[model samples]
Target: MTSLLSAQESGIVLGSPLFAHINPRQLPQLLTQMQASRRRYNQGDWILNEGDPCQAFGLILSGTVQVLRDDFMGYRSIINNLESGDLFAESYSLAPGRRLTVSAMAAAGETGILFLQQDFFTDREQISRGGQDSAQVRANLTAILATKNLFLNRKLSYLSQRSTRQKLIAYLSDQARACGSRRFEIPFNRQELADFLCVERSALSHELARMQQAGLLQTRRSYFELAEQLPETDSPI
Candidate 1:
């Protein structure tokens, strides 16, 4: 079977895990009644442009995409980096017709996405038929939103700190935990990491060199692995 068919046969339903925030029962109705398509994007392709109308809710099946915005002064700031199992194009769920404030682009690898039309989620009866208590539903949604808010806050905090060392340390620590592995690969390359962190590439490189010298981490091409004895504060859980 193809990957898509295998996924379906495995009973891997939509809106699970990352989207477990939504009621599971509602998910079947949400998916079956709505349209979904698997689309591919080559590396460096734009999935969405800034100011585009948010028309659908997207889920990342594989690969990485960076969310960024170009300022009036023509400087680009990366808001976030999304990887497999992440959700995107979520604005339509909150506010239809709202323009995407940031642009999304496939990063190093090809990306696969499944998107649902926004209007499909607006059916109150369908949403409510899941039989979850109002409080339970609100709590689930809150947890989902809270996870996103926390991630944003962490990114902001990292950017606010002085020195590339601090930012790099924070980023690596965050990634280690997110990947749930002591030895894990970063989702982006050095250049992409520098861009996402809003730092000069040369400066970031120097800091990374210093980090390697300090025996905190090791880099092999685009992948980084945390040395067994990273500084106490730098070690990921």
Candidate 2:
């Protein structure tokens, strides 16, 4: 565990969505009671490793982290990308003594994370005696978990497509709906996007070029515009 800064000294806005339901003035006390700590990670650092004991859950305060899973043969896949205010590993943390199934790595920038030990929330005495504060924290944790579950389900839907073009269309369509525009900037670049979609980079590039030439879409690096609607069938390259 890295040396941690006090919540106030860390400069994270307690009013962020993760803590929105709690009073800002009481954040410090809440953190103290929960035995939370703020830790920083440099670019490419591993914040959590697969098979490691998940004793705590983390909430991103700044920068980005990529959740990844690797098979026995060491083929890695990007599970998800988490940004500020996003929580990770809550399910594993809640299960006492369980090991993590995914590894979390800091993206290509500095990242700050707030970690709260599972025991802080699961201890029977604390839950029974701590009154409204503990209850609020538990409620917030439940809400966060529910939201993350929905996100994972959407990601699974995207990943389940059999064709690269279908995967691309599924991802782009979701992005369009999320931003409420036919044009939007995606977070991943070409190679990162390829890894995220679980496709060969060269194959993904070819598919993108084919789509652009067909007037289905226009893309410039991360920026994308849906020039025409995607087909209902899975279109393989």
Candidate 3:
């Protein structure tokens, strides 16, 4: 069963970008106004389903959330995998009549999410009454949405690659850049990586095995080492 947002978890939310410039002392009132509630989900539990009304903006307080989409044939693809401190559903929350196109599921044990209703941001009367806090949240929300757009572009860069090797190269190279090293551990497993890359698991595995044999890269599970040239992708086009 889910419980109330604890003091420590509230601190995490207050520290997030969406809550930037918000005063800690006044956050309780803002939470009350926004009708914020905390919920917990076990691994594999669906937190939000596709076609559902997207009325709340969610913040991950703990664990991982996998944003996924499924086709009519029930094939699932991972749109994004978010971890602690990441925000979700902000765009949907801001859209008056939007429904979610993707479902969010817990990808780790006991993921905790704090959901704040959309009315607090949309209510003109509330915004007028809210003073600086409301204005700051509005600014923060804009920043969050803008950041999400950049993230979308980054994901597109990976997906737009012509081949599985190219896609993996784009993604792993970026990951290495982010970690400031050619060696790092990725968050996704083989299957999750395949889903995120929109490729068949067998194909992904086969490609990785080929790359390994060719000495382009080395991998033991999720850990990888690019031996030279940021060219873990030199194995492919």
Candidate 4:
């Protein structure tokens, strides 16, 4: 685990939404009280595996984490991608026995995580005062969980589309709206995007080519530009 001093100096912890509601002056006390630990992970590192004991949840201070689930036969599906300021594994960490169903892996480059154990919230005497301090912590946790739930709902809406084209359109349209621009960069690469959309890479590539030819969009690696207005129905060609 990295030291608190280093985390503070790096600004990773201070910048994260997990600590956004915390007062700057109280940050040291909060960290010490929660026994928060910081750790670094390289690309492709498995931060947590399915069935692993989820004693704690982590906030991404930098870089990204890919949440994936694998079946009994070893087929894997990407559930979600989390970036800086996002929290992961809170639901599992708070549950009894605290066993995780999904695996979290480091993506892109080096990632920094601020881990807070379950006791951080449960042990009121240690981390929270009776009045405003306790209420603020609860508010922070509620906000995080609500945001995560909404993100999952959006992912589900994207995945529910029947065709590869529809999925692509849904994802791109959502991204454009989120970015407030027709031109944007997506976080996932070819294979990762294929996995994320639950489509075969070859099929997705073929669809992209078709869409480009149809004047739907243009793509160069992760960057994309919507060349024309999307159709009402994103049905398969």
**Which scores greater on lDDT, model 2 or model 4?**
2
Q: What is the TM-score of each candidate against the true structure?
A: 0.74, 0.90, 0.92, 0.89
lDDT of 3 by residue, 1-237 (tens): 113567778778888887898777778777888898888999999999999999897899999999999999877799888988898887888898989999999999999999989988898898888879878988898888888788788888788788998888888888888999989999899999999898999999999889888887899889999767745343222
Instruction: Give the local distance difference test score of model 1.
Output: 0.68
Global fold similarity of model 3 (TM-score)? 0.92
Cα-based lDDT for every prediction: 0.68, 0.81, 0.86, 0.81
Which pairs clash in the backbone of model 2?
Answer: none
Residues 24-101, model 4: lDDT tens digits:
667666667667788899999999999899888888888899999988976668888889878899889878786888
Ranking by TM-score: 3, 2, 4, 1
Ten consecutive residues with minimal summed lDDT in candidate 2? 1-10
Question: What lDDT would candidate 4 get against the real structure?
Answer: 0.81
Ranking by lDDT: 3, 2, 4, 1
lDDT per residue as tens, model 1, 1-237: 233424542134333343444554455444555465668899999998888787776677777888888889777777778776667667445585588888889876778777666544566765565344333433544566678887788888778767788787777877887888767786677777888889988898998998889888888766788866544332222
lDDT of 2 by residue, 1-237 (tens): 113555543445364555666655666677777788778999999999999999888888889999998889766788888787778888999997789999999996889888988877798887887766567778877887888788778777778888999899988988998999999999888978988888889999999999999999999999999965777534221
Cα deviation at 132, candidate 4, in Å, is 3.2
Root-mean-square deviation of candidate 1: 4.6
Candidate 2 regions off by >4 Å? 1-13, 233-237
